[model samples]
Target: MTIDTTKKIESLIITDQEICTLAMDVIESIRQDFNNVYYKFLGGELKVLWSNQNKFNAKASSSGDLKSPPDHSVTLYYATAIRIYRDGEDLYDFVSSRLNKYSDLFEKLNLGEPSCLFKDLEKEHFVKNFFFSGLTYLFGHEIGHLVQEHSYIRRFFCDSDRNLNASGEASEIEEIEEIEASASSKQLTRRQSLIWHVTELAADHEAITWCLFELVRQAQEEESIKFSQDDWHRLKENTLIFSCAASCVHFRFNGVKAVYPDEFPIGTHPHPMLRIEKNVFQIISGLEFFSTALGINSSKAEISKYINKGVISANIFWIEKYFDKNDLDSGLLMLGGVINNENTKKYMGLIVNEWEIIRECVESIKRYKPFNAGNQDLGLMFFDENFKKEFTK
Candidate 1:
């Protein structure tokens, strides 16, 4: 949890091809969608691979500069990929072992017995499918960074002498926007930090939506696995569950104080729990994004169950895996405190407001007609009528 990733120490690096191959397989599984939906959309070749770095981290970077075409790379460190895979399995085993006590919870969420669900396939399918979704998210997240073309690449082309304000002509300090105001250094520093936070969240939104729809595309098109109506529903449920479980695993690595910057200069990425919890809304919108083409027809009530129970699943695994605690009630209580904290609410508002402010910037440049991650430009606010109803009804 405390290893410095700045420098690569051969003593700590794990270049095991097998460990890296699991992530590769996930990319391979979704390659069809990846290429079809993102090839030209991404601007250049997007290379995703495993890193030998020993840290529990992943990063998106590029090599070319202003003179040359940029090629983006998203590398998942071996330590990060391996831990996420293992932690995901551990979380599932922990919950499955306690199914007796949580039978009501499982039944309410339509969670099928792992053994039964995978009986037609390999026993490990339960772990692989859900964990693969988690892995898919990690890869997609890096790609999400590339899709945004945020400050990282802004220096090359965004030569405007003005902030990309969403509405007003006011000056702002954010993402290489060229600070034009006489704002104090502290205010600029603080606002820059906030912009970085919003930048990370925007990528998270893109990645999570990419992840859900990719999962939808994968599940719908899978020819190897035939599912009955009930089994199809269960598959959808677990896909949603492990997506959150993956967030818990990430939180386990990043620590829980990530709710807000005041919690301690939370860096580019927000805490995984806050990222996980609020993204249920994103998942809802994402399903709607792909529902028409994919024929995803879950009701408002069923979608509600997925989000409610997903929170329960994430809280349990987060506490058990991170705090080394097992009391479900206590875990839920702790989660409530984290979510309801005034600072967290404030941080949430910051992202929402910043999102609106920068909406024009992203939409103007983003090439649209997603197969359907950000299906369209204004798809920023909502995916469709169904997405609107999920919240309204």
Candidate 2:
């Protein structure tokens, strides 16, 4: 597969440069601790692209005396970065507004000043960091796919033709799935779908791990004032919650929910709400474990209540936006109807039950034990040099 890298479309945006810089900073931060990886910023409308000669090929059966350049590269498009930022801004506005209605409840939790935090969210630096951290998770997710060797494992067990397109968009695969009815005939299709969903979940796990690590590191580096261990932990947990909320809104705004089984089956990208719920569960569970390990008798339910407020706000925003309604009451009814559906409930339960395994997988990845060692030879590509200069000007 050949791509025309020279098809210059438009110039890069400043936000794009900042997002790329954040991603690079993350890669650099983890470079020494883990195997090296490469990144490039492509100038195109497409959001992101990961290129590798064997991206769609099965792993080699045996080691060979082969010396070649790194086979994988992660590419971020300037236009997509802009889209994410804009969508993030919209989501922040929506979620923050909704949260304000329940400001009293959040304030009672001693979780700090809700009004002040919302004010800070409007600041230029905070807004940038918000988008930056969220994009970092997304970029980390792509890197997860690479390091986890998802493509290799997938191609090894399934036919390459069953793979989704490079863009990772919904395609004719659903149509193909519909044509096959026999249980034996559908086995491969089901396997292919399951792998895709599992890989996506694996990537989400990686994103959450990296996001939490980055947030905690940022909190530790604060020098303006000293934070008690408990305070720091609270701050870290809240920041993670906020970032996860932002991510939920970000993906929800950009993605369409699968209203029909054929359009979105068990194997495609899980519903944005399910993903959000899973992240919330995992983060809260991890916090519970961490607090216990530290001998802190923190109220897990209290912390979760605060976080769930935000999650519920974001979910309501999503529901209102997607559901046609004249008022809040009608929207709530529609949301209830959707949530009560047998299919939605089944998938939600399945995802909820998988939280323990997902948490375990994330913990393992955080230890830098990805299935593949990742490619070290790729190094950092200078694809964004000109964009950086242009943006700085």
CA lDDT, every model vs. true structure = 0.51, 0.44
Question: In candidate 2, what are the lDDT values of residues 1-393, reduced to their tens digit?
Answer: 100111222322344566545544543444323333232221111123422331111111111101222234345444444555555565566655654654554455444544444453433433454555555555565656554545544554455554444333434211111001111123336546655555566666665655554454455434645435755654544464455444443343334443232222354455454456556665665566555654556678865765655555555455566654343343222223333445655544443334333434333323234323254211111113543333233
Report the alpha-carbon TM-score of model 2 versus the true structure.
0.58
| Model 2 spans > 4 angstroms off | 1-70, 95-122, 159-188, 221-227, 230-234, 237-242, 249-267, 294-297, 322-341, 348-393
lDDT, candidate 1, 149-196, per-residue tens = 564433223344444321223333222211111111333235555666
Supply candidate 2's per-residue lDDT for 314: 50
> Which residue pairs collide, candidate 2?
none
In candidate 2 the C-alpha lDDT for residue 361 amounts to 38
RMSD of every candidate to native, in Å, equals 9.3, 13.5
Backbone clash total for model 1 is 0
| lDDT against true structure, model 1 | 0.51
